[model samples]
Target chain A: MDDLSTVWLILAAAAATYLTRIGGYALITRMRTMPPRLEQALNAVPAAVLTTLWAPAFFNSGWDVRLALIVAALVSLRYPGLIMLAAGWAAAMAARHLFGL
Target chain B: MNRRDIIDGLKGGAVIALSTTPFAVLFGAVAVDNGLSIVEAGLMSATIYAGASQLVGIELFGQQVAPWLIVLSIFAVNFRHVLYSAAIARHIRGYSFWQKAVAFFFLIDPQFAESIRRAETGKPVSFAWYMAFGLIIYVSWLLFSVLGAWFGSMLGDPKVWAIDVLLPIYFLGLVIGFRRKPGFYPVVAASMVGSMAGFHLVGSPWHVSIGAICGVAVAALLPLPQKPDQSAEVTH
Candidate 1:
């Protein structure tokens, strides 16, 4: 609530966040050789981690959000990043403003 | 150190920075609305630098959640960065200690994803390119957060512009970009199902790690790639 404590809390949270950011690298660096299964798991990290960002939103949100993500995924299949983003944004804006979803 | 790498990194990061602008602004606005002063909101964005966790931290802060609990929540929300840095260790291990330290600090979702992509594609993950990318996103993040805080109350509902959909869609794009990787389908499916279940049963932050662990477990269980010849008796 107070300024000092709020600052302290932010800094503490920052430290904890940094710990997560580096914790994996620190652990891996300590190892001389990595196991195959562990390498597989690490290779899987991108899809695994990034999926959580959207899957819950897709299953939980309204039609507008779902439509936007679907549109984005479709665009991504054929186009580049900026184009995919634009198409998704357009889809969402149209869904909400034009169709009132 | 190549000029081309700098240009490439800047161009790529600038696109992501633009995509992330809405969320930064949204976080800034929400932070202020939740009783954080403008400076406090900016500080959170500057220091934690993880968008989703900063949001969760601020939401709990607004609710007057315990300080330690808030820190723990940020840690939980950001736990995936551990996996990211671990996954990327081989690619950037050649960097100096200080470079790694600074690189790890800027290891946001996009940064990690892009770095992994670069490495897998055989491009050198030069520090020049890496920081060019990271710093662009970082600076824009800090700037827009403060801007959003400054204009917090003045802005209307985000839903009208559909600003809420951008982040999820952006992340969806990133997820789709990894479709060619081995075990992508099963892993994504497991994470999706696991996350949806966790979202219903558990809640935010926990769902991320829970789903991630589920997906990673599926990845571990899925058939290992058969490398040619004596791949050194699989040892854990």
Candidate 2:
């Protein structure tokens, strides 16, 4: 694509993305309060979304990644966020080098 | 706006930034390596911001895919953000139109998660807090992407440093963070199983959205044991 077209493509993509971000809010605002079932569903969303994001990566990865995930999960019991992440990263690096993955 | 809110927002933003920075850097380096100019790569990151979609866009561009198709595919990949926006709409209801417009630009996954958590805690939702969280991640992401594009070759393979593991690990930590909440295990199980099936069957990033929808459906259908006091208080 030409330079101008490329710029237009990026601009169009940005517009589309902004629509997704704002569209849902606009729709929900029109409804005022959500129904109970919808509320339950929304409440479950974070866990569901996070799981969907992580599970494929966990299952598809090699032993090093799997081991790293296990380490992260175990560490998450005590240290929920950055600390767990740090430990997991360290463990993954260790597993990769040690096992030559 | 308050000191406490700023501190809280920063703390939340920093945690997410820690996980996301590597992904942004990797995207920058890879985009440059794949024939995009530094300016193009920067513009893509600044505009798209969503990591998975941006990566897909760069890959398709490298393959000489039509620009329209590239943009459409990225839109599909990021459609999940619509659901996120819907889920968090209640919290931001008080904000004016312009504030909401600007805030939605930074409505990435981490910001959504933090805002939802705050809302659930029954505290008044602070737009300032959410903006602070989003701004930190946004600025750092743009900065790191440029840095990566400029010096990415020196970093070698991102996988060599185990950068690939960061996201899944960080997300795993988030799933665990919900351990104390009611209905956690069942919700997580439904989501994971659904997502795995979607990954193997549906392909692409559709699995994440598919799994999320299935999880929400399943969780909503399950009968909850009575907690009259808690159940009486409605949550949005």
Candidate 3:
């Protein structure tokens, strides 16, 4: 593994994240009011990007993985992240080992 | 420098710190699972300090995605913090230039949400209090990441323990956390389909950017809700 490259990547990510953390203040300090569309776009960012991370995995995986994710999603609607995570992990373990899925 | 504000910040931040410990640990484990050294995992937690993005970055790293694309994905995932800073901007104007800079570095989701709630409830969002809150969560996140990485390095097969399932489930949880946001359903639906389709056609990492762009674009094109001022005029 290229440790140097990974370190650089981590630093770059941090810099980019920092840019976002301060980007809003820079914009607001310059402009009087933000356009409504811009606000809407920003609001939608979390769901949009996050869905990309998991949606494909859910689509591509087998019954065991699918079951785990489905259970997790269901749990997440009512429970917090930790519970949802635990439920999914348990489901995966059961499907893979006990049920032999 | 009100002592009460600092104390309150510490109390509130401690709760957030505890809540985020699992995630920091998860990130460390997943980071190692994806080929990062323990020190690299800690470095990511210490610097990026954003959980979801760190996980996303490591996953892309595991896939041998282009470095630039991985960085872009992290930036895109962390983009919501822009809104955090924007929303809290009015309250933190009293902070000096460097203070605001340091504060922005620590503007994770919980801090953003807490600061907003406190400000709305007539609490002063003092720099002293904000730092007190952010620093505790920051330290916990860093420490646990290294701990998880150390433990993760010792694990034999991630599949046996179903560790591979954790990231997707975690991301799913994050996606659900935003269910109440405007345009969330359509936006997520778009990203989901777009990403799956992109995974089949374009391939591993491009799917991320493609799907995200599709969702955000859908959000931009969606009809705007009536502004409060405009709605008030109509009611009157």
Chain B TM-score against the true chain B, each candidate:
0.95, 0.88, 0.71
Against the hidden true structure, what lDDT does model 3 obtain?
Answer: 0.82
Query: Model 3: what is its DockQ?
Result: 0.54
Write the residue-wise lDDT of candidate 2 on B86-191 in tens digits: 8887788677788888889998877887787888788656777877788888888888888888876777987789988988887788777767766778888988
Pick by DockQ: 2 or 3, better one = 2
Question: Which window of 10 residues has the lowest lDDT sum in candidate 2 chain B?
Answer: B227-236
Q: iRMS of every model, one decimal?
A: 3.0, 3.0, 5.2
Question: Tens digits of per-residue lDDT for model 3 on B1-236?
Answer: 48998899999988778767766777888888888899999999989999878887988889968899899889877776776676577778788999998999999866876786687579999998999999999999999999989889565566888877877887787778777777889999998888888889987656776787789889989999865222111000
Top-lDDT candidate index: 1
DockQ score of each predicted structure, in the order shown: 0.65, 0.62, 0.54
Native contacts retained per candidate? 0.78, 0.72, 0.76
Q: Tell how far residue B225 is off in model 2, in angstroms.
A: 5.2
Candidate order by decreasing TM-score: 1, 2, 3
Question: lDDT tens string, model 1, B1-236?
Answer: 48999999999999989988989999999999998999999999999999999989888988957888889889988999999988888888568999989999999999999998998889999999999999999999999999999999677898888888888888888889999999999999999988888888999879999899999999989987776233223211
Tell me, by TM-score, which candidate is best: 1
lDDT of 1 at B47: 92
